[model samples]
Target: MFFLPLVPINSTTTLGRQSQYPNSWDVVRHFGIRLSDCFVVTQFSADPRPTTASDALPAPRLIALDWGTTSCRAYLLGPDGLVIETRSNGKGILQLSADPATKDAEFAAELTRLCGDWIHEAPHLPLLACGMIGSNQGWAEAGYAPLPSRIMAKGPALTPVETRQGILHIAPGLVKDAGADDHGLPDVIRGEETQLRGILSGKESPASSIIVLPGTHTKWVLLDEDEVLDFTTSMTGELYSLLIHHSILGRHSIPPRHPDEAAFLRGVDVGIGTESQEEGRPGLLTALFSARSLAMTNDLTADAVQDYVSGLLIGSEVAGFTRRWVGRTSTQEPPRPSITICANPSLASRYKRAFLRLGIRVNTAADDTTAKGLWHTAVLSGLLAKEKA
Candidate 1:
């Protein structure tokens, strides 16, 4: 429903970097895909005019939104892209009205409810959004962009919704090579792409790197020269949740939080296939059972099992990805990448530990990368110069 028929047009495009095109119609014609088809979307709007010298000047503040599956988050960003203030609507796409017809209206209403006061205060500030808010199931079906391409070269899929405040620009999600996936889970990322953009904005080299963004569904991205070379996804956090609380293996006491660093590292070792000595090492499913086995049998403490299990899952994700990408040995030997971890402090620490365990050097990205990323995309697309829609 969000495709919009690739019709002929004279209006502006939401796609950010492909500035040569006179309109979104021309932009799509040049690229052969809708911005949404190329990426995904939440929504946003621009002034529909070219950015001027003044528009290019550093802005005092802007709105950076990370609207995902579990929640809607807004950040009031300073000109340098640091967070000035934050607002959260503990609701995500899943929390919207179920009926399709009313969903669009709710998207507007919910965002207004979440950031209405801020919008009222700063009437013309551009609003940039990423994540599920742009999916087919979300406000608009801003298509998907294929991988091995410039992540921000093209702006976002412009899905603008009208409201009393202004237009909400839904960003696009990127889809991996359609031909590569035979079993059908073509790699795709919505919000992470924006976060990666934010990360690159701060770095000197546009050269490629192994950047990992950890979350409910963690993303491992290979960015090259401002392009998204490729990526993969793992349901690390979700798996931890299901295994530790929903499955039989999790049918034990779980404290709210615990230290248990030793047990966690041990779990990481197991996940990396180093902790086990048995000739026939157990698989993850079988290894998961040990959380309960050890707890019930007094091998793992009740307080430590949860963190240990978490370590195992995260460690496995990191190790598996490393083996596939970082460990590949070719005759020419590709240059070793500088692995950067972008996540909240806790998750970043876990991932950094995992990489270090295998001797991989890493750097942690600032926690505000997502917010800054929103800013970068907005500037690239000339959104800040525009008036409220």
Candidate 2:
């Protein structure tokens, strides 16, 4: 029931770049259909005002939400799933009251506060949400869809939570059982599945590709066309934060005025070693000490130390994944799969740099993919039917 509204407005704000309209226009052209119908609104507001009928925008067809642990983003989509406007706030699930008696009420209040005006104006619009909002800790438990599942295949019904406004459909997360290929441990993904669907929507997905989502816990998802073959998670970001703030490697570190790309690449080079070096040199465990050692020797600046350590961790993760999953040997190179990074611009840039250093070319998904994924899921789940207009 919690509806949101979007309207086109003029703004020079682009998602990540300084250019105006070029990137947004490119997305419209890429979709091929509904060029005239599409409205690209990249500007988001922390506190969005209500829209009146006088504005005369296209009617919103759906209200999509990407609600996570630490933040929640809501989007209003017009015909063809064009992003109308977006509202976000820091009231993530973690901010909700801990008392079970008040938790549901808290969630309802938060949703209403986020998009109450839209709900009042468009009471019947379908509402769809993804991410931790459907987890055990979220508003309701939308269980995991089993592994080796089709990304767009229908039929694992969405969990519905009745809110003050209406029923909100929640997408289930994906789960993989412990198996020979999964490092003998099970894995789960909640929010990233929606992002993956968004990345592949309206495109002829490659036969096989590696989708990397960089975050606190980075995910390396392997997809074969529409199906999710397998995935692995790496805690590279979390570890980096821990080391830089709490560990010895970061003891002398200070924030760099600018990024030290050279230092970062040097760390990457060490992590992705030559065959001879790989055979004789120690692994990440031993190399981690070099951050402090190099600093002590005055060979590395305190400001650059953090970037160097970041590169080392990310490079190690890439090297490990490639070796184990790709089955590359010390002497023979394996055929590389197409890699795409779906993340915010900053995080994506870092991962892209790391992969390029390892001789891997990668594609970056659009920044608005989460919203697109939510819309796609809503359509596929029958929450929003395709419109002819």
TM-score of each: 0.77, 0.83
Candidate 2, residues 8-114, lDDT tens digits: the string is: 34332222133254455345435542322433333456774554443334567888899998899988786667666577763888889477789999999999998
Q: Considering only N, C-alpha and C atoms within 3 Å, which residue pairs clash in candidate 2?
A: 1-166
lDDT (0-100) at residue 83 of candidate 1? 54
Native-to-model Cα distance after best TM-score fit, residue 162 in candidate 2, in Å: 1.2
Q: Highest lDDT among the candidates is held by which one?
A: 2
Error of 2 at 363 (Å): 1.5
Task: Write model 1 residue lDDT over 1-389, tens digit each, in one string.
Answer: 12222222221222232233325434443555422233212223353333233233122357767888889888765454645446665478888958888887887888788777557656667787888888877877666777676755656555665666688787788888645432655678888888888888855644657888898898988877778877888899888888777876667756646567898898888787733334887777777777777888898877788878888887778877877667632224433776889988988999888777776767898777777678777766667544211
Best-fitting candidate, scored by TM-score: 2
Model 1: worst 10 consecutive residues (lDDT sum):
6-15
